[model samples]
Target: MTVETIDTVVVGGGQAGIAMSEHLTSHAIPHIVLERHRIAERWRSERWDSLVANGPAWHDRFPGLKFDDLDPDAFAPKERVADYFVQYAEKIGAPVRTGVEVNSVTRLDGRPGFRVETSRGVIEARNIVAATGPFQKPVIPQIVPEDADIFQIHSNRYRNPEQLPEGAVLVVGAGASGAQIGAELMRTGRRVYLAAGPHDRPPRSYRGRDFCWWLGVLGKWDLAAPAPGTEHVSIAVSGANGGETVDFRALAREGLTLVGRAERYANGILYFGAGLVQSIRHGDANYLSVLDEADAYIARNGLDLPEEPEARDFGSEPECLTAPIRALDLADAGITSIIWATGYALDYSWLDVDAFDEMGRPAHQRGKSTEPGVYFLGLPWQSRRGSSFIWGVWHDARHVADSIATQRSYLEYHAQAEARSA
Candidate 1:
């Protein structure tokens, strides 16, 4: 079979792939970036129409690039963020080939490289960087049967509330996506119910600064990720309405029905646990933890930062928590649609390398996988808490590029030495 050969192949064309290409080019490494779709396709297609980045514009961006005349603290609209990646890729002359889908990656037979099989053709590379990212396949638990009466869609497929069928909406999973979508649906004069789960709630801003700034300054962003296959709690925060915190109490007052994590859907009814208050408290504790850390930092450093009184006030408990229901009859509530904001599952089945743990999570230190010449980028907690984020992913791409370059040089040196002896 005829096969194209390159020094390196980077899978994906999102922020991570493009960033990897930039670093590879800087290292004078010849490579090709294969993108299944257009650059930042997920941002353009997968996300909801009203979605805004959780991070502020300045903090979410790559190094030496601005989000086009926007203020530092302003949360960039989704389209603008996609445009920024495209613009950055073009500026850096990234070798991105769009619409080229990679089917599998396997080691070359008795060779020191990998064979990447794609829809276009086969390409052999000395090294491969799996930058497909954390959000791949949408995860939908089988709590509800396939023949359920209510229409269901994952957050990945949701565009806007208008697309959903008429009736009350039950949004399962109260992560950033679910909470924002649930709130948006409520604003459209539709009855919305949110299924609270284990998630951290961070304030949009603390002490006259965006939470992004505080995370960076306080070294929270430098926090390490848990071991591979370990589940991490979602951070439920939003950039909606310029920047707003999700106060369950406020959402409750605004007519949002808060329930515990969805247990099951049976007999035309949805069942929930009695952990509604505990779920809210989980978020409250996270919210308070960050505030306490920031406060201590200011006090220890003798920095004069004004304390916001309203933020610390966790008012009286809402009725939903005081009296949590165990079940919701779908027909009685007039619920016609269910949006599962249950997040995405990582899919590395196409990777024919022994670079993953038993749970199929990438088994690696930082971005380097266990298998030589096989690396992973943009994984959640791949190295740090910020590893999956745009900026953090970019930084990780640089590190991966350095590793590839160093390994390539070592291999070439050994090959030359063997040739001289021969």
Candidate 2:
């Protein structure tokens, strides 16, 4: 096997990897990005066809590139977002080797670096940056029975409503993806049932500007403090047209049957908990808490902002607030498709290093791994709440690159001293 050595090796060629490569190049660091598939493979293959970015285009810009020509306020589609990454790689001439799958990453016994085994060849590097973003693999619950007659698919594989069988659809997990997909399926004149969970649903727009703009002004996106017991809730706001809010209350009013958390699948039946109304109420309370914090911040800073809009009373929809049914037979309800939007799981099995925590996740502090010369990027809450977003990875990437440079300088100094002594 051929062996090549470099200063650094970056795994995964997504936004995080590309951003880190740009910073590493600016620092004159010799590195290459290894991708198992094409650049932005997840965005291209995993997302739905009609999906657009959850946030505005303005907030999704990378470090050196801006969406100058595109409307900053409009949400860019999935294809456009994927193309942006492709264009970025070309613009910066990033040293990305596509289709190169990493087989293993192991530390050198006596050396001061690591050996990365790949499908193409083996690379020895002083530093290794795992830039694989948070959504590593699709998570399908084991509770789903294998012998079921109905067709099932994860949100990653779902394209559009037409892709599924002609019948009612049950979308499990009412996060951004689940809510959006359920709403879209409803528009197709299909009956949709959403297995709701405790997920915060912020208004799409507030006053005369987007809610994201408010978050930016309030410094909410840059917050790094650990929020206890709120890890699974997605911060992504829904992207429904007509400036309409897309929360549980809104979806309920739009003819979506809201169920409780899914328990398990029995003999042709799916069981649910009885906390549907409680979950929705709790999620709304969480949303209100965020707005209250923003309001307090504005008041304390004495900043002149737009007048708060009059609140809409969602209490009129009392039917959605009722107790959920404990179980529903799939055949009786005429439901033929099940879409699991229960989020994703991280896989670092190829990494032959002991840098993971009890959850099998990489153990890193602000992108710096516990193991020397190893780093991680694109992890949710890695440095701040925005660490996993396209616009946020650059901040962590810059820090990791600087840390690598400092370590490289020290190694060189030590080598020179040893040569002089010899």
Candidate 3:
């Protein structure tokens, strides 16, 4: 295999990687983007057809490009977002090596650099940018029973409801994806079940405005201020406008059965505890508590916000669970199609760097990692609102590239001084 040397090597040519490449290009920094597949391949192949982004067009843009002439509140189709990523890469002229799967990255002994081994070839770089992104793996719970004859798939593989078995299908994990899929299935005359999990509660319209109007005024606008610890963990802003005000309410109203959290699955049977409904009730209360906390924070801080946007009420409460249903319990509900929307984690075993935290995520502060000349960009929650959406990644990528340039300059200055003294 041929070996090459470069100033930087970016792993994964997704939005993060492409954005970083653009930043490096602007500064005349030489870098190569190594992608396992074609750019935006994951989005094109993994996401379902009905899958739409919670973020609007303006918020879904990348560096040097803006998603225009699209509905601001409308849920953008999967294809549109995927195409945007591809166009963004080409627009910036990123040097992307497609079909190259990086096996491992080992630190070189004397050069203080990294040697990246990939299927296409081997490359040595002064710095390595791990831009694989958080959505690298699909999360399916072990609670699903192996004996169940019913079809089961993760949100990644699911494309449409027609692909599911013609029976009552249970969707596990009632986050944005699960709730949206469950609601759509029920509308299509399929018996659907949704399992609830911890989620944030949204208001009808704050006082009397579009939820996004308030979010833009209050949440997205004040991005520079550091977010609270709670905000970093979970923050609830209004979802896209639809028939249902909230996902849980919409799914419940559409004749979808609500169930308790899945305890354990075996022998084609799922079991639930008696306090499942009570747990749902507690979750609702917890959501309200968090919202109230956020409101109080806004009031105390005296942050200027827009007038509460008005929205029509979609009604409240469902008859099946008999409790204020926010989250669905998996075990109590006999769901066959277990769609895990619990979230994602970064698993980087191929990376030999020791700078990662216990969770396999690279440890970084403001895009600068502990390893000299190395960095990361586009991580979920990397900086407040930095990795929340496509537009956010550009801000992070610029910051990281700037830091890389600064560090490279320092290294050059020290090296030249040492050479002259010797």
Candidate 4:
């Protein structure tokens, strides 16, 4: 096979890859983006039809391009998001090779680069950026039984309530996806049950301003350190309008039965852990703490802002917090379908290099890997809290591109010095 060479090779042509490509193009770097499917394939194929961005359009723009024609505050639908990526790629004239799947990335033998094995062909690159994104595959636990009697689908596969089998539905995992899916299912008059988990609940809008706006102003997105015991805190937002709030409390109030964290499915029965009410309360407290921190920042800066909105009574409907059942037989509950919104797992099996830690996560400082030319992008808290989001990936991308350029310059300089001596 004839081997092709490039300055850089970017894997996965989603928002992260596209952003990285834009920076590389601006830097005049000869790089190619290899995507297994179409650009933003997750938005196109994995997401539900009704799914919209959890954040507003205004905040989701790429570095140079803004959402000019669309409403800034409106939540962009999945289709629009996919189109935006395509348009962005075209606008920048990105060297993106769609439908090209990368099989493995290994060091070039006795060389100072990487060999990227792909479906198309082999690509030798001076640098490689893994932009596969944070959400790689749906993480449905092995705990979910293999029984054929009940239908099961991950949130990525779920389209709408009408697509589900007749009868009640169990939505596992109460993060943004779970809360939104449960709420949507409940609207269809289906008996929706949500399994609550450890999550953060921030109101969609607070004090007549979008919570995201406050988070931006307060530098919440700039926070890089994770909370002591948590890997990352999931934001609770719905894509109803440009965006809306969706939390366990709201879902419970919407007539969706709230249950504890799903422990296991055994013998035709689903068992749940206790502390459903406590979990809701804990999430609410965490949300309040964030608001308090923002308020403190405003005060420290002496910025004249609007008066803080009166604390809304989140506890008004206490009945929703009650966990009436800890275990339910699948048949007795009349639940015919289960949607696993448990979250996603990042896979780096294609990386045939020692750049990962014992936990199987990339060992990198910021976005640069310990192994000279290898780098990572679109990782949660890779550089900051926004690193994983569409609006945030550009920051990390710019850093990676600049780092690659610097490494290439140093290598070229050394090569010239050695030639002069010769």
Leading candidate by lDDT: 1
Candidate 4 per-residue C-alpha lDDT over 1-422 given as tens digits, one digit per residue, 9 for 90 to 100: 79999989999899999999999987899999999999999999998889988888878778678777678888888899999999999999999999899999999899789999999889999888999998997888776676648899999999988899999999988788888888889988999888887788887776556777888887788998777876755556676855666656555676789888889777888888887877777788877886687678778988676765654456455464653578989899899999999889889999988898889989999999888889999999999988898989988999999898888788889999999999
**Top candidate by TM-score:** 1
Per-residue alpha-carbon lDDT of candidate 3 for residues 1-422, written as tens digits (9 for 90 to 100): 56899999998888889889999998889999999988978778987776666655645576477766476545567777788878888887899999999999989997679989989778999889988887877777777655555577888888888787556787776666666777777888888876664455455344333444445655643365444533423322323343134546556776887776666665656654455466455446644543464466568877665533233233576775675333433334444466665556567878888777777668889668877766877776687654646777778888888888887889889999999999
lDDT of 2 by residue, 310-346 (tens): 5445655547466567899999999999999989998
The segments of candidate 1 whose C-alpha lies over 4 angstroms from its true place after superposition are 226-230
| Clashes per candidate, residues 3 or more apart or on different chains | 0, 0, 14, 2
Question: What is the TM-score of each predicted model, taking all chains together?
Answer: 0.97, 0.95, 0.84, 0.95
lDDT winner between 1 and 4, please give it: 1
Q: By descending lDDT, how would the candidates be arranged?
A: 1, 4, 2, 3
Please give, for residues 328-393, the per-residue lDDT of candidate 1 as tens digits.
998899999999999888998789998989888889998999999998999987879899999999
Native-vs-model 2 lDDT?
0.84
Q: Which stretches of candidate 4 lie over 4 Å from their true place?
A: 297-311, 318-320
What's the C-alpha lDDT at position 303 in model 1?
Answer: 86
lDDT (C-alpha, whole model) for all candidates: 0.90, 0.84, 0.69, 0.85
